[model samples]
Target: MLTVQEIRELIKVVDESAIDEFTYETSGETVTMKKSGSKAVAAVPDNGAHTDHPVDPVKNSQPNIQVEQTEVSSSDEKPIVETTADFDHEIVSPMVGTFYASPNPESDSYVTVGSKVEKDTVVCIVEAMKLFNEIEAETTGEITEILVEDGELVEYGQPLFRVKKK
Candidate 1:
């Protein structure tokens, strides 16, 4: 059996690490802790294996939305462009897996920056549980930016790309 001091030390070490989850088992002791990152406003008891401590549910709960608005005068010496952040974001890949841009190595990318995409456009493919899942762009617009890299592990509801509403 592991002593209380041993458990405390293990928890401290796991808490300091960047890994989201950790686990340990001894002859008569087992402990696990899962960290939820910096976006969770509150932590609830998740019915997974790790429940020894309350995990902070910050970064993985909801997307932190930000809107910025800028105004420009019409009658000015220079033609000014105003920026109004009134667009909606299309999040994709609601699973834990690797995201790929193309179907294979020798295929063209599904979408790119400045590419106009319609609803149901296959933006990317996510590989989960050894199965390929094609992720589509839920909204229609020009892909302004891709929020993730090719062959990257994506979290649930992670913003895959930014679309400027048309």
Candidate 2:
């Protein structure tokens, strides 16, 4: 199994090079990465397990969606106001794993919305192949939002938090 740092290094190398696609298999785990224009997306399947349904890579591509909020005012003449999500920074998952907001079931979350964090702060834990990896903030900021719910499966490069950088 590749460590999170190793996986990150692989991603960096691939991004710096002209590789369009890359795949690696180790100890029954398979990681596939594909580059789309300037960004790269990764998928790691557990234990080389095959899904019952065939996956359509194009249709299954998970794109980041910006949440839009609309507000309506009631008056003699009413108009709708639209707003889009905006954040200074995004903390993305470095590997495919199950996201946990805390170290243990009974423990408090490492950080919550409005929590101030340093570059080395541990914001969450991601479990992969029975190993619990503590993920860092990597930037000085205040967390504005937690994107993934607890115990959610996260893909590599998936945004886990929205932060307002200091």
Alpha-carbon TM-score of each model against the true structure: 0.50, 0.56
Q: Give residue 155's error in model 2 in angstroms.
A: 0.5
Clashing pairs in 1: 39-58, 39-59, 40-57, 40-58, 40-59
Per-prediction count of colliding residue pairs?
5, 0
For candidate 1, lDDT tens digit of each residue in 1-166?
A: 4432343344455556676656565553334445545321111111112111221111122233111111111111112223344446765545444667777766778899888888777788765434466776778888877777786655445567778877
Weakest ten-residue segment in model 2 by summed lDDT:
66-75
After TM-score superposition, the amount by which residue 37's alpha carbon in candidate 1 deviates from its true location, in angstroms, is 8.5
**Considering only N, C-alpha and C atoms within 3 Å, which residue pairs clash in candidate 2?**
none
Q: Which candidate wins on lDDT?
A: 2
Give the whole-model CA lDDT for all candidates, comma-separated. Answer: 0.51, 0.63
TM-score quality measure for candidate 2: 0.56
Q: Which candidate is the best by TM-score?
A: 2
Name the lDDT value of residue 28 in candidate 2.
Answer: 64
